[model samples]
Target: MSEKMKKIIKIAIIASLVSSAYSVRAQEDELSNDSHVTTSFVKRQVAQNMSIGRAVKSIVSNYPQEASAVVSTALDMYPDKYQEIIHAAISAQPMLTEDIVKIALEKNIASCANIVKTAINAEPSYVDFVVTAAANSTPEELNEIVRVAVITEPDSADFIVQSLAQQHPNKIVDILSSAIEAVPLVGEYVVETLLAIFPNDAESVVSTAVRESASERANVKRIIETAQNFGLDEESIYKYAKEGGATDEEITAALSEATEQR
Candidate 1:
């Protein structure tokens, strides 16, 4: 072939190859965009049609960290189905409960307390996480949470109280007082835990329990016994108890009983 014809043929071949490569690239980009849009639409439909339980299972099955965000959003959108969704999600993926609770608290979700309470109630074993999360809440909110926890799960009261007390020693008296008030039966356990952790604050703890729990005679007796067992002097116990509103008759009877025991 002539040189010019040969060169023309080679140029045409190169041009054709370049055009084919551009067409393939354009097609790939279009396909990529279509795939993304289709995936997103499917996800939305799945979310809308599936039950919250299935939605949660699907999300947490792969994206565990997104559990809280998903739950929080679900709660905002479905106020009426609050408990149902929460229970369903937690029931489906128990491990995600902690993440759900932590995110709820971090975001200051209004129903954080109820969520924690429900989570703990459903699985008492999560009490530690629930209590820890509640510790970050306002004092009043924390108090209410503690009250509900102690009242509902009295057995978990000791652990809950101890965790909060250790975290906020200054609030020990108030926390214990609330716990004792809710379930006076927990008073003895509270006293024992308090004295073990805050021996120096024993007087304050006893006085608060006595003053606040005077109506609860059994609780008062438990406090007095706990104080005595901790080696607090009889006079100091009586004086604090008196200052805490123990009746003269109640103090005398308690001290007399203590002496007999000694």
Candidate 2:
């Protein structure tokens, strides 16, 4: 597995454990009084700022360790404001290992990396901060952040693949394709992590991941054939075939099986 994939996955697993630890205690009826501030007050302060992005940065920068709390405040101040700033930051830094890419990409929600890339280049160290915070974010938040960040830095393939392989191998199976070109090492990881995640989509994701340039030629061919013989189909078959570079016969085999099932 690539180092990038490892780091990303590591963050995901860590975030999951941490969130689960607190979720049970945060009952819906239990109103947040201390660390959890209200949203309206945040909006009023954001309005006084020059720009929403700047306003967000001001909070995170000044707070340092409180980046998460500050962002929460910013969102309460302006719902989704934090996401917008993240989008801007990721957009600006395509090459940086945006630890938050998965924050946006989880659960199949499409993200606009172009918008996030704009702010990434403004500061390289911000990459580290985003990565750390992104790791701390909840699964849902991580998914959203990733959906946006992946598109923002679609070129950081190594980071994406390794992170998932080691941390959240389950999720990496599907969405690692966006940056395969930039991080060739991750292609193999994509296949490996897909197999590890072992969800309904694993077969398809693994089949496709094998076709990436980083994939071993023999391994790619083997997975494509396995997918066809196993009878996967539709989006699953499409995904596998898309990556496998399967010939007409191979694709037809998978499609035929899917068609029969339907």
lDDT tens readout by residue for model 2, 1-262: 9999999999999999889867535422122345553455345446777666665555444334444444444444444454575553344333332433433433223333432343344443354344334544444444444444444454543444445434555555434554343344445444444454455666557645655543455444445444444444456755656565755565556456544655
Please report how far candidate 2 places residue 66 from its true position, in Å.
3.7
Residue 255 C-alpha lDDT in model 2: 52
- Which one is best on TM-score? 1
- In terms of lDDT, the best-performing candidate is 1
Error of 2 at 77 (Å): 2.4
Poorly placed runs, candidate 1 (over 4 Å): 1-50, 61-65, 92-96, 106-112, 248-262
TM-score of 1: 0.70
User: What shift in Å separates residue 232 of candidate 1 from its native position after superposition?
Assistant: 2.8
- Residue-pair clashes per candidate: 0, 48
lDDT of every predicted structure (CA atoms): 0.71, 0.48
Superposed by TM-score, candidate 2 places the C-alpha of residue 238 at a distance from the truth, in angstroms, of: 23
